[model samples]
Target: MSKQNNYSYIGIAFIILVFGIIFVPRIIDRITKGDITRQESRSDYAEEKKAVDSKLSDLAFIESFGEKRKVPDFSFTNQHGKTITNKDFEGRVYVVEFFFTTCPTICPRMNVNLVKIQNEFKDFENFGVASFTINPDYDTPEVLKAYADNYGITNPNWHLMTGDKEAIYNLANKGFYIYAGENKDAEGGFEHSGNFALIDKNGFIRSRIEDGNPIVYYRGITSEDEQVNDEGEREQISILKEDIKKLLNE
Candidate 1:
């Protein structure tokens, strides 16, 4: 072929290539985002999508309860004279912590976090917080009641419980997977962890939040561990709320 004819074929091919690059998308992205005509034409598709989203918005798929385990079932009296059973709380998410009313350190910090939780979901129904005192003999129902009142724990959702020491200790270990016992000489008198546990509607332990205060944050780990700023407590708190909301919504 002549050189001019060859050049002409090359030019035509380049033009075709440019056209393919630029105009193909116009054909391909016919259903692209924010397209006017496509949007109008596919209104039914959009409506169907919207219907799906709307159904999802209103869908409430509460989870089914699994095999019920015997979580340290014990009889404890609430701050009020109401004798309470753990079975009464079977279908709700409750935050449980262990601290003596006489605790002088992390217990206050723990209760502060607990009160924050209570205040957070104050208007929400079926969520409660309980702090079972290790020194239950000392932290009687009256003492717990007074402590609750003094702490401005006005919401009925918060409780400070007192029971037999052995029962409370066992519940602290088996139910919450924390340590609370009669070591009355530890810094805050009787010693226990500053661990915060979230129990779901079906009594499944969904998550645990560390106390996170540097002064009291060292309780939950091994003895050689050091406190770091990024041990996932913040994310755990967010997940805790999400799981609680999911349980409540269910």
Candidate 2:
């Protein structure tokens, strides 16, 4: 081939590469409807894709609930002093966390991370955050409202909930399968998991993120590990955000 022809070929190839770099991701984003490529690793993406695919089948309910775990029905008051019930979340995907307003340890960090999630999904009508306080006696509606105000949480979907202590404990331990109890040795006189539960539209627990590790619906079960560092907490938030997107798409 002529040197001039070779140079032309090289230039065409360069132009193609530039266009690919600039436009391919945009095309993908348009097709996917958003940037769903933020998953940390190829394995994470594969796992989430598998979950999404399986969720379309009849086996999804079984997969999401290994032993048919469903969050038991309950009525609780939110920061706005309005009643919220399990039935209210019937057709929505919600994130739940066990916490108290006066917690001096992991609760603050957990709340901060939750704000990240709340902001990310604030515009999605199907997405919500339900924060159930373990210390119901201390965290009344007024207290929760104040705490929500401090965090600048104005979203009506983000419910700072407080209700029957025993009911809350049972829901946390039995329904969500996370820790929540009174402990004299623990900070603020209460102990609870910093983990977040991702509940599907049908009231099944689809995923759980404690610290940085994520357990998806089809994956095998795992317990919450609270001894996580700051980096792990941040990673957990990232995983939570990705999983929420997956659930929303479902």
Candidate 3:
């Protein structure tokens, strides 16, 4: 071929290279829908995923703050003269209250409410009820047993406990976060909380219900000068019944 023909071929090659550099990408983008801006469009699934992620974050935050508070370990004598301890309640859920058998006021109401709970949950093998007497000096195992009989409570899962005064008081005030102390000015010469505690299988104090409302732990006691009305007692027991079921299912 002549030199002029070779130059003509080189010019054609240069024109083709320039066009490919500028227009080839546009052509590919048109054919393949490869524009990055178009890929940023949102869909319902993406919105849903975002919402689910937000909910998960919120749940994580709640768990960080609401981790379970564990009940302290304890041992005491039950109504049947059996030695009961924290180990007996391991892997089980139970309700606990502080009371004496002979109290002329809240103790009777507390026992009646507890019997209601005992009857409601007696079928659940993992459920139990415990009443720790603040006046252990007078409430012996035999006395507790007699009190249990007076209530017609024969369920072995229900325990009326009596033990050292200080140990029982410590378990009430510190472990269960309830109040139990000697108050000469109070009814029956002793003061204790009317609120019932729901303990989980792992021994954590999961919930406390009083007066038909869920109250803060350790704050359900009637003051030495105050008395819990019958209406308040009934409401608390009703709330406690539902809370017990909730913890059991959990």
Which predicted model would earn the best TM-score? 2
Poorly placed runs, candidate 2 (over 4 Å): 1-66, 208-234
TM-score of each: 0.61, 0.66, 0.65
- Candidate 1 lDDT, 33-126, residue by residue in tens: 4587766769978898887565332212222244333345668888997777778778777777788887776777666555656777888768
The clash tally of candidate 1 reads 0
- Those runs of model 1 whose alpha carbons end farther than 4 Å from true positions after fitting are 1-70, 208-236
Q: Which candidate gets the maximum lDDT versus the true structure? A: 2
Return model 2's CA RMSD, one decimal: 18.1
How would you encode candidate 3's per-residue C-alpha lDDT over 1-250 as one tens digit per residue?
9999999999999999999999999898886674544554445568878875653211011112466467678889998789999888887878788888879877776676667677888789989877899999999999998888899786677778888888999898877668889999998999887777777776766655336544643223333223445355324455556666766765
Query: Relative to the true structure, how large is the alpha-carbon lDDT of every model?
Result: 0.66, 0.76, 0.73
Q: State the lDDT of candidate 2 residue by residue for 1-250, as single tens digits.
A: 9999999999999999999999999998786753354434666879989987776522233243347557789899998899999988887888888888898977877777777678888889988888899999989999999999998786677888888999999988877778889999987999877777778787877664445544642111111244346454324566566777877777
TM-score of 1: 0.61
